[model samples]
Target chain A: MAYIKLDREKCKGCMLCISVCPKGQLKEDKGLNKKGIRPVRFLDKDCSGCAFCAIICPDCCIEVYK
Target chain B: MKKIFGRTRSLRGVDTHYCQGCGHGVVHRLIAEVIDELNIREITIGVTPVGCAVVAYDYWDFDCVESAHGRGLAVATAIKRLQPDKIVFTYQGDGDLAAIGTAETIHAANRGENLTVVFINNTVYGMTGGQMAPTTLIGQKTATSPLGRNEKTEGYPLRISELLAQLQGVYSVERSSTDSVQGILKTKNAIKAAFKNQMENKGFSLVEVLSACPTYWVLSPVESLDWIKNTMSKVFPPGRIK
Candidate 1:
């Protein structure tokens, strides 16, 4: 199974990752992060490990593992 | 579990001051990744320009020197000439390069300085508010060009990469964008190629990256990216110029 780790504190909630995620496993969290921005949450579904989200993240907040 | 992607050691383990979804951070990570992949962090020296990325040294772990606005190429030229063994590069913005520093950039490329240049063309000035830059699209509107850039007055967006590519001193020039995953990957490859060229002493190499300025463009980060892929690419088409 593939999974992605998010550095919540560093996330600026740009949502660029959400737009690129092929699996549609990411979504905006209802809660705000340390920066008071709505961080993205992974649904823990089947991940393809494409790393597209990580590649498109402007803040370098996501790390993908397969 | 195998780690497919992560931050590079060449980048400092600190948050950048750039706004959320800023392209500068993405480009910074790409440069750091390239530095790590080439194992040149120790020998590489970056010259920072006087624009939004002026404090780029804070994010890059390697040595960096600050240059006057539009003088990044001149400083890089000097560094590369003084220390031929070291890999030198300049990180400049559209305003710093195509506008205020046009002469320096042209001269450095003409002199065939063995160096790399990472030119970020966001079309507008981001740090000091959204002002029409030399590379701004003719019809694009900015603070200075509230009614859109008029060709009769502003002439046209300066195609610096194409202009530099025409010079015999320039070895390679590519215009890449960070609009999508594929585009970002291409941009990284272009940056790596530029760095590799400098390592091989191939004379001047430049990778002009079409970056996004969401705040100044009055669009969300994602929408700004689409704008780059759709509108901006029409004018500054991404491809190898030389």
Candidate 2:
């Protein structure tokens, strides 16, 4: 199974990853991090490992592995 | 199964100071990825600008020299001239490159300096609170231009890529955006090409990247990307200008 990890603290909660993920594998977290920003979370296990989120992320907060 | 994506060692283990959806962070990762792929971490040097990314040296894990506002090219020129073997590049913004450092940039390009320049064109002075920049589009409202930029007073958005391409000293000049997945990949390729051109001693090369400023643009992070794609791209089309 492919796995995508998001570094929550490093994320600026931009949601750019959510918009770019073709599989819709990521979603915004309801709770805020220490920075008081709503970080994103991996939504499902059906990840394509496309690395699109990693690429488009402005904060370098996502990691995709297979 | 193989690892597809992760952080590059060329970048430090620290969060960037850029705002959410800021293009500097994305570009920083691309540069770090390129440095890792090229195996030039040991011999690469980056010159920092005085804008939003002024502290870029702190994020990048390579030797970085801080340059005065708009003097990135000048500093990179000196560094490259002295350490002819090192891969020298400059990370600059529109305000630093197109405004304050225009003379230095033009002269460095004309001199055929062997170095790479990653110019982030967000169309406004981001760090200084969204003041109008040399690349700000017409009718674009900025901190200084509250009613939007007037052609009669502000003239037109400066097309640095096209102007630099006309220089005989420049070997490569490309304009790319970071609005979409395809655009980001293209931008990475363009950045890699710029660095590769410098490595081959192919004279001056620059990649003008049309990035987003969501906070200053008064738009959401996602909306900024759309602006880059639909609005920004029209004024500054993405492609190999040279």
TM values, all candidates: 0.98, 0.98
lDDT of 1 by residue, B34-125 (tens): 99999999999999999899999999999999999999999998888899999999999999999999999999999998999999999999
TM-score for chain A, candidates 1 onward in order = 0.95, 0.93
TM-score of chain B taken alone, every candidate:
0.98, 0.99
Per candidate, native contacts kept equal 0.89, 0.89
Task: Please give the distance, in angstroms, between residue B212's alpha carbon in candidate 1 and its true position after superposition.
Answer: 0.8
For candidate 2, the per-residue lDDT at B9 reads 97
Residue B44 error for model 2, in Å?
Answer: 0.7
* TM-score of predicted structure 2: 0.98
Q: Mark the 10 consecutive residues where model 2 chain A has the least summed lDDT.
A: A57-66
Model 1 pairs in collision: none
Residues A1-66 of candidate 1 have per-residue lDDT tens digits of 999998888988889999998889999999998789899999988799999999999888889899
Please compute DockQ, using alpha carbons, for every candidate against the native two-chain complex.
0.90, 0.86
